[model samples]
Structure formats: C-alpha cells, structure tokens
Target: MIFGNFVSGLIILFERPVRIGDTVTIGSFSGTVSKIRIRATTITDFDRKEVIIPNKAFVTERLINWSLTDTTTRLVIRLGVAYGSDLEKVRKVLLKAATEHPRVMHEPMPEVFFTAFGASTLDHELRLYVRELRDRSRTVDELNRTIDQLCRENDINIAFNHCGHFTSP
Candidate 1:
C-alpha cells in the first residue's frame, strides 16, 4: 500500500500543469526551467547560474510563467531623446525598428508611448511582444542598433545628463 501511494504521488507530481522548460520568474529571479523532478525543480538563471527550488514552494509562491502553453513575451524599451527631437519622428523610428525585428510578434503589433517630459529630454517607451524568449538578447541588440542608426541618419540626438557643458565661442 505504501509503495502504491508513493507511485501515485509521483504521478501527481509529474503531471503538474506547469511543464518542463518554461520561462518563469520566481520572486525577482527569472530563469528557464532545466529539470522537473518529483520533489524539486532546477532552473538556469539568465546569468547561467543554476537554482534548485522545491516543487511545493512553487505551489505557494507567486511565479510568473512567460511560456505557459503560449510562447509570447512582452518587452518594453525605454529611451530618452533630446528635447528638440520631433516626437512623431521618434515614434515612427522606434515602431519601425520593433516591427522590423525578426523576433518580434506581429499579431499583437508594436506600440510607442511618449512617457514623460523631463528637464533635458523627452522620455519614450516602446512595447512589443516576442514569441521566443531565447531570442530576447539578440532582439534587443538589433533594436538598439537600429534605433541608433536611425537616430544618427535623421540627426536626432539621444540625451544624457552631465555635470556641465563647455561651449567655445
């Protein structure tokens, strides 16, 4: 009878709704699932660190699973451009970059927001959904590179706050 119960428990544990290899965020740490044992699970952190967490803790903790049956993830990119830059042009460039990226999702579409007016620059936010979490880094790199190239070609300057600026007259 004890052996039967143990087998049943194992079945229950293995049949959990959360599957192996899901991208999950527990507390503030986010990682990809490496293994799902009967009693615990192993996840590989973004920095390649391994974390072993008990299965029971997952039941009681708040976990954000990015790939639960659906492999879509939302990404937000924030930028601060100089005050003189045209808002419409900035939005167009950011949206164009996000949509043109290979990893970005097209069904949900990309959006750009004029977030805030700061002392020196205008804060903008770009949001897009990606279907693959593994390609996040590459997508971000491409997006930033595109943004920089577009800004340079259009003569739009990204903003940075410094202590002082010396002008030669």
Candidate 2:
C-alpha cells in the first residue's frame, strides 16, 4: 500500500487536484502549498511553519482549495451591534466600507446580510470577494477598522456577550 502514496502523487500531477502556491486546508492544516513531492506535500501555514502531509492524505482526506478556481476568494465578516441600532444605517455603513476598500472586488458588489437578532445585539454578516488570497487579512483589518470608526461616528455600539442574569429576590 506504500506505493499508493507514489500513485497518489502522480494523480496529483495529472489530476491537478491542488497546485503549488495555492492556499488549501487539508485535514487539520491550512496554508499555501510550497512543494509537492512523490510521497509528501508541503505547505507554509499562516504561522509561517512548513507542514509536510503525506500524499495519501490528499487522496483520502477531504480538502479545501481557497484559491483553486481563481485568485478571487469570498470572505465573510460577522459583526454584532447592540439591539435598537438602526438597521438601515448599519447596512449602509457596512456596504460603504466594502466599496471603499481597494482590495475588495466591485463585481460581486459586497453584500450585507441582516442575519439574526441576538440576546443583546443584532447580528449581521458582510460578504465580499477579494482579488488576491494574500490580501484577505489586510482587507479584513481595514474593514474592521472602518466598521469600528463608523460605529463610533454613528453612535452605534458594537455589542458584547449577553446572558440572562438570575437574581435572588
């Protein structure tokens, strides 16, 4: 069965299930593929550590390729605002933030979903696409900063954990 690894390596080359420089999550690891050998595949993880995964694992385990089809990748930013905040304003603020960011793609036209009502807040999700996978982090940070600023400027408060308090009467 050891030859299975070699065969799997060949399959990868021919099938092109994954490619070098692609960001993928294989089993417990997620990173950019640095090298693909006959018996092992290497990835440089977010922590900057090189991970060597057996070629058979790719054949057996479920895998994800964030940049497989194209360099464009969808990312979601989830946020919660204190209840009673104006929903319309919230949507506009998030939309503007996405549109203003240069790295954010315009075609998908970033969408904001007024998802749920929380115990202490209103939960919403911002879905956007980026041109480069590597820009994801910086784009997120920019979006977050913008959201924080917008929330502050608009007097919208970002909510925290809320729990029912049982008081002894």
Candidate 3:
C-alpha cells in the first residue's frame, strides 16, 4: 500500500490537480491544501481543522479544484417577492445590487432571472461572479443588505413560505 501511495503521490504532484493553498472539495471535505506527502495530503477546512487523506484517493475519486485555473467563482442568490410586485422593478433592483458592488465582476456581467411562479410569490435568481473566492462572503453580505433596502424602498415585499396545519374534531 505504501508503494502504491508513493506512486500515486508522484502522479498528483506532476498532474497538479491541486497545489498548496488551492481550495478544493473532495468527497464530503472542502478545504485548502496545506501539504502533499508521499503517502497522504493534508487539508485545512474552513473550521480550521486539519484532515489527512491518502494520496491514492486523489487519483481515483472526483476532485474539484476551485482555484485550479482561475479564482473566479459564481454566487447565486434566490429572491422571492410578493405576487403583486413589479417584475421590471425587481429586476432593476437586483441588477443594481450586483453591479454596484465593488467585488462583483463586470466582465461576465450579472444576470437576474425570474425563475418560477411560487405558491405564494414570484421567484427570482441573481447570478453574479466574484474575482476571488475570498470575496464571496462579503459580496453576498453587502448585496443582501443592499437588495433588502432597495426592495423596501421600492415597496417590494420579500416573500416567505407560510405553512399552517389544523386538526379539529
């Protein structure tokens, strides 16, 4: 097993599917590659825990190297509004929230999609790209705040699912 793992490690080093500092998701683990050894690799997850995985797993299992070629990543935000809201205005507000954000990419351009007719609302999706993975959280935070403010100002009610059950004799 050691001999096989060493060979697998060599393959991983050369193929470079993931490098030190690269963010990846392998199986149920998502984290940054901290070290690559002859028999195993170490990943530090977002929670700051370190996980050691056998080198052969990289060759056999599917891997997602989020920072392999480029650091750009897409973020999707789903929004639902009251049925009577103005669709055009909602689109404008979502676009405004994305475009005005500093970290959002202008090259790909943000998109607003009216996705579905929900039981209680109109569903919309905001698709935007960020230049770096690090910007995802902050971008979403700012955009959500902006979108909520804009929706309120425009008199758009952000919808929520309501469930009720009653049993009577």
RMSD of each: 4.9, 2.0, 1.6
Prediction 1 TM-score vs. true? 0.83
lDDT of 3: 0.94
Ranking by lDDT: 3, 2, 1
lDDT (Cα atoms) of all candidates against the true structure: 0.82, 0.93, 0.94
Evaluated with lDDT, which candidate comes out highest? 3
Candidate 2 whole-model C-alpha lDDT, 0 to 1 = 0.93
User: lDDT per residue, candidate 1, 1-169, as tens digits?
Assistant: 4444445336536666456778898777789888777666788998999997666556656878888877777888889999889999999999889988878998799999999999888999999988877777788888999999998888889999969879999
Top-down TM-score ranking: 3, 2, 1
Models 1 onward score TM values of: 0.83, 0.91, 0.93
Model 1 regions lying over 4 Å from their true place: 1-15, 165-169
Native RMSD of candidate 2 (Å): 2.0
Better of 1 and 3 by TM-score: 3
Candidate 3 clashing pairs, residues 3+ apart or interchain: none
Candidate 2 residues lying further than 4 Å off, grouped into runs, are: 162-169
Q: Candidate 2 clash total?
A: 0
For model 3, state the Cα shift of residue 12 in Å: 0.8
Error in Å for residue 48 of model 3 = 0.5
